[model samples]
Target: MFRTQQSRSGNDLRFSLLILPGLRRAGMVVRLLMCSVLLLALTALSGKFGEAQAAGSTAGKHRAASSGAKGRHRSVRKKAALPAKARTPARGRRHGRAAAVVAGATAATAAAAVAASPAAPAKAITTNTKPELLPRCGFTEASRRHIFSRGVYVLDEETNTPLFERNADTVAPIASVTKLMTAIVWLDQKSLPMANRLEVTEDDLDNLKFTHSRLNVGASLSRADMLHIALMSSENRAAAAMSRDYPGGRPAFIAAMNARAQALGMPHTHFENATGLSPENVSTPRELAELVKAANRYQLIRNDSLDKQKIINIGRGQLQYINSNRLIRYGQVNATVQKTGFINESGHNMVLRLLVHDRRPVIVTMLGSGTADGSRLDGVRIAKWLNCSLN
Candidate 1:
């Protein structure tokens, strides 16, 4: 029995040893599996972290690029807001182009305006240095209608004022009105007697003008009668005879006339004869007014000139002479002194010391009338105008 027991124990030991080796192998395999599982989980976690870091880096780069772009846009805006002097070269180029366009448009508009508009007379040259002689007045136009004489002068005798005048300085023939000066020169001779009879001869005949004479060649008359006929009738024979009978004869009488005219400021007067038959017998209206004023101082001249009619008895027959002035003959005007004259070259002429309202003496002289009664009509018009305008 003992022997069988020992053999069984040895077999049990062998079986135990084999079982230990197999159990050791199974424990090693389980520990290796657990380590591999833990390594796999750790690797998956590291991959997820790496992916998160890459995504964050890419997002940061995009944000930085967007911010840089905005800053550049702001810088460009700031430069654009500067003034032209402070502007960059690029901005100056833009402004220069715009100014060029405006200048071209302005030039074109000015050229069009100049092309749309019309063109301007020439003047005469004169060398006349004489000062104007016509009186300056506001009523020149109105007074022109009231006067018909080519030469006219109206003066206020009392005040020695000029009322109206036209061409008064024009030199013209005096015609029979020359007798006024002749009468003045004759009367100035105090030695000449009024009752001295003077014989009419062939020299008294009007040889130049060839005018008719009522007094015959052999007729005789006193100085008073001769003077009366000469002044009243404007008889050429009577005037010639009186000049011949003067103290120094015809030459002396003519000299006295010119001297008297010069003394009276008659600058434009020249007398060739006493009868005013010659065309050379010239005087201006301004000068003739002075002659009238001087002659009016004589009572004989004033009476004879204003006389309507007078009867003179010579040896042959009874003769009647009438004043030539129609104004005095018809009593149409209260003229204190007057004379009438007519010649082809001188035209109709008249001078009068007209008494307005029987008080004021207005001297009016007219020359170069176109019509026979033109001077008379002018006198009437002057009277009417003075009455209407002044009164």
Candidate 2:
């Protein structure tokens, strides 16, 4: 069908030429035929040239490879080629150099990244054995919710080593735990007549507001009565009275407390107030245990601390104050002395010295208890756990 159409076109052109106004009809026909032949030759030549160009470009980009060809020392053919529409740029002749620069840049980046990272040990050190976790201490299976603190601790009356421990060095307020220390220092410093006519004054009542004590104003009380109320009931006024009665008043009392803590080797402990009102008044469970041990050395602190019940006749007459620390009657161990402390900032804090199964005195301190019962339970739990596990 295509050949038929071409034949028809040629016939029309030939017929048109035959009728054209010209020097002669035959001559005009011959001239038209010659012109058509020349056009055909030119079209064929253009097609061949285009095909050769396309083939060359598809072979590869031209590179100036050194070689001997023909008569010239270096034969330069139109070796580098491009598509008919796209011409090659001279700058791209240095492709190898450009690639080298990029390779170097990548290597440098890798090296910099490696250098910036933490270095592994030079030796190919390796271990395949299972690691040893510390032996479980203090109530190992006890639920964490039942614990009074965020840390782990172990109490053994026989072995001074912690049966268990976790972050035991952190310092925190001792709360009424401060009173035991106060009583210890008092017993040591004041040799004034045991009945030195100690009186609870206005300042003592005023200080009770911050201490959570129930001591009323205008209550006349003796030194011994104040000590019992303070140690057993955690009365702030009683503690304050003791602090103010020191040789140099409260500041002197605080200095003595700090001095005594340092002397006791409680390196991280500090006392800003005698009644433990300030959250800044802090110590470690480890240090508190030390303080409890030291406190037990004194007769008054040990006796009052061990008592589970007490009845004092203050100015109010026939006043009764129950022992705040309940571990004394827990029956886990015979507690020689114990004190309990609680505040929003300190939670429930308690310390106790007890006669253990082997007759060794074990002292324990626990902090951040969940409830009022927490401190007492912590002491009994530790004691019980120690007997079962450590022994």
Output the number of the TM-score-best candidate.
1
Report the C-alpha lDDT of model 2 over 1-391, residue by residue, as the tens digit: 9999999999989877875555476797899999999999999999999999987776533322222223132223343342222223456758756766777798799889875554332121111211111113223233334666643344554556555454568877778789878888888885645565576777775443354456666676778778877887788888888898888898998999999999999998888888887788888887887787787778887777666677766656767777766665444567777788877888887776766666766666777877877666666666775454433
TM-score of each: 0.63, 0.60
Question: Cα lDDT of all candidates, in order?
Answer: 0.80, 0.69
Distance from true location, Cα of 143 in model 2, Å? 4.4
Lowest-sum lDDT 10-residue window in model 1? 118-127
Per-residue alpha-carbon lDDT of model 1 for 1-391, expressed as tens digits? 8989988998889878898788888999999999999999999999999999998889888988788768667777788774333222355877877777777798799877764431100011011211111112112344565557999887877777676777889999989999999899999999999888888899888888788888998888888888887887888888899899988889999999999999998988999888889889999988899999999999999987777888886777778888887777877787878888888999999988888667877788999998768888887776654443331
lDDT of 2: 0.69
**C-alpha RMSD of each candidate structure in angstroms:** 34.8, 19.4
